[model samples]
Target chain A: MRKISAEKIIAVISRLCIQSNCQINEDLITSLKHARGKEQGRARMVLASILKNIKIAQREKLPVCQDTGMAIVFLEIGDKLKIDLGEFLSLSALVQEGVRRGYQSGYLRKSIVEPLSRVNTEDNTPAIIREKIVAGNRLKIKLLIKGFGAENMAKTSMLRPDAGEAGIKRFTLDSVKKAGSHPCPPMVIGIGIGGTMQKAVSLAEEALLEPVKSKRAYFRGCPGLKSKIKRLEEELLREINQLNIGPAGLGGETTALSVKIKTFPTHIAGLPVAVNISCWANRHQEIIL
Target chain B: MKTKRIFAPLTSEGIKKLETGDEVLLSGIIYTARDAAHQRMTKNLKKLPFDLKGQIIYYTGPTPPSPGKIIGSCGPTTSYRMDPYTPSLLKLGLKGTIGKGERSQEVKEAIKRYSAVYFIAFGGCGALYSQFIKKTTLIAYLDLGCESILKLEVEDFPLLVGIDACGRDIYQQQKT
Candidate 1:
């Protein structure tokens, strides 16, 4: 078993937290510019200006988008990991330490509050991490910092088994319509199908981490699954863009740039569907070591 | 449409010239308080902590500041979350409010009643927004930490007026 230093994990995630708060993945920029080409009217111009701002923020070492989202951590651990659960706490103290350090050092805005009290901690720390133990020797980490603007607009439904594909499509369309201009147009969509309620949410989030290109590491893990999900995603992408939500929810054809679906075998009693909407800036990156 | 620059710590005249659909670039003093502050502001029977008259309030709870910086990556939170307490603040003679997302009808009606406007400075552009905020100070509610009311001095901040006093909401105009 190779030794992995605890401090090293803490340090890397710290930098990642700050970097996620500062820079958006360049892939999202490319996708957005492509979407911009497909749009018209004020929506198109809004996208054009957004492109300009992205450049400005990058050159100046500033955050690419506003609404510096709440911090989310995805951890992939390997077997024979030597870290003590006793040291890990109920969750991991190191993770929270990274959040505290990252947000404070990076000057990221803190957004957590005493839930009901609604007080802001302003550190943006006390982040959320979802971790799993998988077949591996090294650790992998991904930060998909999510802003409230887009997160607030996410919707999910527990569809009846007989709802069928047509019903699914109609529900998806209705949800987007109800969301309308709120989630910020030109959104990246993650559709989760065929899972339990909570699992569906996880699947949607997992799908968001997939690469904008056709080949995705997350999807690669499960053999023969890509083509099936890929077709559904592209079809949904076409339908959502047709809605004309545009950039910033202004009317136009490019409301959604791309849609990716992730499915899991669920109990026959439930067919849960969830939509995880992300704004134009798909600010996420992964490190698999 | 062409945009014009205006200063915050707004005046009655500043409030008047602004109409629905007019884009504005604001400078001068601004304040930030999110959901918690709204609750307390509405809950207290006592006098409010600040002279809210003619002040612009930004509905945001930014990232904490790094070493030596005045504030963190600051951007607007959703406006609708604070809708419940907005009418009372408007009646207290506040100039304007900035936030991301939309507002409720009650707040809109209160805005019309008080002749105040709502502006937006981009939803997730925290890094961009922080650049305009030249300085910041904790004004009140220290117990609340980041939710504590903050006094921010800004310059050349760009925004679009989402709602105007004459009973017009740009979102409403856009929808109809």
Candidate 2:
């Protein structure tokens, strides 16, 4: 068994929490610049301001947005790997320690408040962590700092099995329209189709982790499935952008930057769909060890 | 498309002249308060530490400042979350507010009735906004951390008149 120190995980996560917030992802910057080119008037002005804000945040080692966001950690651990915890009890505890250290040292705003007492947690700890066992002996950790401005606009629906592609398209378009500028357009929309309700939501988030310009591959023998998914993504992207929500919702042609969709098999009777919207500050990164 | 420079403790006449979509560079004092502080203030309206008269409250919860800096990434939070508390504050002579996103119909009515205006700073531009905030002091609800009420001295802060005193809303115009 390959033994890895839990402390290493803690340290990595600490640095990641700080780094993700400070550095606006390059893909998002490129996309924003592209959108800026197509936009006019107030939309162009809004995009320019966002790009400028990103540059300042990078130069000064400050958060791009005031809402540093909730730390979401995705861990892919190899079954052949064993962790050397020493006195650390669980992997989650170590991750929480990292979050605590990062939030305190990085001067990030403590946003997690108790639901009942309404008291601030002070330390943005106990991050939303999703772990899975994979094939290799390598461990890959991915972190995404999700700002609530866009997260609050997420939508999930369970449609009739017979709803078909048109129904799916309509729901997606309606959700984006209702969201309008609230989620901070130009948005990167993540669509999760099929699976159980929670699974669909998680899949939508996973789709977001994919780089904005990444390619969509067709399933080798399943042409029908491949075409359906690709068409859905293309259509959604086209329709949502047409909403004219623009950048900062002013009014323009560049509303959505991209629409990424992830699908999985689900119960025969249920057709679940989840839409996760991310703002211009698309902060997420992955590290393989 | 008109640009104007204004100071805080805004006057009714000055706000009336402003229309939705006008760009303004704001200066002078503004107060910062977000979810937690708003809840507490509304619950105990009489015990508010700072007077609301002729004052403008910014809906934001900024990051803690690094060493030797006046403040950290300070930007507006979603304004709709503060809608319930806003009408009450507007009733107390609050002349203006700054935030992003759409306000409720009732909040817009309060803006019309109380002769208040709502401005929207660029959302997600925290670092840029911090450059405009010259100074900041903790005014109330310190225990709330970032959610505490902060008195900020600002200079040439950029904003768009989202809703004018006449209830002309830029967001509504854009949506339509």
- Over B55-169, each residue of candidate 1 has an lDDT whose tens digit, in order, gives 9999877666656666666777778879888988888888799986567999889988888889865555666677778999888888876577989998888787888887687
lDDT of 2 by residue, A46-79 (tens): 9999999999998877888899998999999999
Clashes of each: 15, 0
- Model 1 per-residue lDDT tens digits across residues A91-132: 468878778787667656566765765656756667888999
Maximum-DockQ candidate:
2
TM-score for each predicted model, relative to the true structure: 0.89, 0.97
Interface RMSD of each: 2.8, 1.0
Native contacts matched by each model: 0.38, 0.73
Q: Give the CA lDDT, 0 to 100, for residue A244 in model 1.
A: 62
Candidate 1 segments whose C-alpha is farther than 4 A from its true place: A65-67, A80-91, A114-126, A215-228, B67-70
lDDT of 2 by residue, B72-127 (tens): 99888889989999999999999898988888999999999999999998788999
